[model samples]
Target: MSYLVLARKYRPRNFGEMVGQEHVVQALTNALTQQRLHHAYLFTGTRGVGKTTVSRILAKSLNCQGADGSGGITATPCGVCQACTEIDAGRFVDYTELDAASNRGVDEVQGLLEQAVYKPVQGRFKVFMIDEVHMLTNTAFNAMLKTLEEPPEYLKFVLATTDPQKVPVTVLSRCLQFNLRPMAPETVHEHLVRVLGTEQVPAEPGALRLLARAARGSMRDALSLTDQAIAYGNGTLAEAGVRQMLGSADRGHVHRLVEALAQGDGRTVVETVEAMRDAGLSAASTLEEMTAVLQAMAVLQAVPARAAQQDAGDPDAQEAARLAALMPADETQLLYSMCLHGRAELGLAPDEYAALTMVLLRLLAFKPAAEDGATEKKTLLNPAPPAEARPPAPAPVARAEPPAVVVAPQLPEPPAPAPMPAPLAAELPPPTSAAPAVQAAGQRLPVVDAPRRPAAPTAPA
Candidate 1:
């Protein structure tokens, strides 16, 4: 037998064999079991999310004969029957698959629609599986609209696309659409373990983890990478080998970069970049990993409950929680945004490693100052006047003492004082009991020779 790639070799054969996309599977399974099947079914999702796989399984479910050739339509397909075996071998006469990407023309579409008039030659129903159907031109789409909306009873139209937006809404409304979600890392990891175990291949858990993460939620991609890893390891999968093959930095390096960034250690970040360069790791991959870590941290900061419920044994989750606690929520979001945009900057810089350094250091640049409530520089509202050089305020000092006198500017002499009445003069105190005198605005009372001279003057007279 010729060598088969892992992606094809481990391709999901039936609904039961599929690992992810349980929601789509459940709906389709119920439809099949209850025989509430729709004539037109549309599957949409990214590549490797089982868009085509689901269509094939549905075909098998409808056409599979039981072990003794006595089975009617079922949710579970019996692989022993002729129809099931032929479909699995991709030689079924009634099941047709069209690659719209290559044959996206009105004539091609019209030719496909013509098959609806004929009945299934070998199976219970004829399945027209169109992959990447969104690539079909508007004219091609128009040609098949009537048939797609109302196909023959014995014919099932399965249209799959990665982008549903490109597919006309008119056509979309005619089919029962089901979206297949990308597989989770854990789900992909478990599936890789199962496949490796079945192949009797010796593999390390860490290697499988790296593969799962590298897959980015694509089971086909995950398996294909595993095949490369196994060959790279010469039949054994090791973390070190897989990491080298993927050209990603060591997990510890990513953690250290994140921790250093959270602590605002620019020196450590730069050194990490140097270390990664020395290890020959890809700069793009380093940023990629950082983006992932930062995103997880953001989620942890945003929703604590969700992060708390994450699997305890997952080191990535634990580290994310720790980082989220270490950094403020706003900082977490900032770092995440920078890392995401940094991936594009790697190519523009003079050197990618240098760009990586800047990207990591960006967080430190925008990070708030230490929250320890210690002002970096003391700023006084009114800085204490240079009190050492000058005495205390003169206003307060002057208020503490009595003013002897307040002299007015020099002026002309004032007019002489007038004589007092005799009755008022009798009420005056002795001359020895003198009171202090004050001058009016610019006038002074002049002293008149007392009447003392009057007695002497009378005697003289």
Candidate 2:
């Protein structure tokens, strides 16, 4: 027998078997139970999220007739019915599926609409399912509008698109649109466990967890990876085998890098990068893995209880919690951001490993300097010198004094003077002073003698 690929082999057969789409399932199931079925429906989501799978299940539900040929429309179809079995096998005549990606033209859409007028030949209702409906052109979309809005009572339309924005509003308005969400890692992991058990594959839980994360919320992707892991492990999955097969960088490398960042060990960080390079691991993958670890660390740090609640089998989670305790939450967030952005830089550099080495060392370069050790000593020694002082001068003494006063000597004078003249005669009588005119009448003159006064030495008179 030929080997069928895991993606096709594990495809969901019914609504109950579909994973990670409870919202769509619950709504459709309620609608069926209430008998309020819409003539046209639309399913939109990312790939592997069960858009097409749900459409098929819905088709089977609307068309299935029981083995006794007495059943009516039901949410849970009887698989024994010809319609359900044939639809599950993709060979039902009443159900038609179109890959809009290939048959997306005005002519193809008109041909599909032409079939809407005819009635169901065998099944209860004819189902027309279009996959990737966003690929249709504007003209094709225009062709689909009228039939989609008012289809024949015996016909149902199911349209699926990975990108809904590309589908026209005219087309969107005619159908009841439902969005399917991507599965969480935990949901994907649980589903994988159920699948592995049914396949009788021996696997470690750690290996399965790794596969779940690698799937990134796509069950089809998870199962495909699981098949590859099982084959690599020869039907028994081991963590080492799975990691080696996926070329997954070891989480220990991430732990060491983060611990070095927390402890401010630049040398250890460089050494860790060198070790990763020696082990032949991709630098981009290392940074990506480290970022994942740091994110987990931040979560555990924010909610301390999560540290205790982690699965011990995942050494990475334990390491994340440990690093979270050692590093500040702010630093954890910073390093996580750096690691994520650094992955893009790896390809731009000439050597990716070297670029990765620089990225690892970048955190050490940014580590804040220590503040308390050597700066305090210089301020204490060698005090300022004292100001200078001068001496005072000596006081003066008193001297002896002299006593009393003394007299000085004098000098003498000399000589005589001329005598004065009288009025008439020197010695006339004192009674009458003669007049000089009478004496002068006679011409010749009378020489008047001076009335002499005695000149002598001066005396006290």
Highest-scoring model, TM-score: 2
Clashing pairs in 2: none
Clash totals for all candidate models: 0, 0
lDDT of each: 0.84, 0.83
Candidate 2 local distance difference test against the native: 0.83
Q: Residue 380's C-alpha lDDT in candidate 1?
A: 46
* lDDT of candidate 2 over 24-124, digit per residue (tens): 89999999878899999999988888888899889988987877989888988888889988998889988999999999999998998888888888899
lDDT of 1 by residue, 1-461 (tens): 99999888887888989888888888988988899989999999887878877888888899988899889999999888998888888999999999999999999988888888989887899999999999999999888888887778898999999999999999989999998888898999999989999999999888898999988888989999999998999999998999999998887898888888877788888888888898899998887887888888888777889885998877877887887888777777778788789999988999988888888777776665644865232344635567587676656444456545555445445456456657766866565432236565445455544334122123344
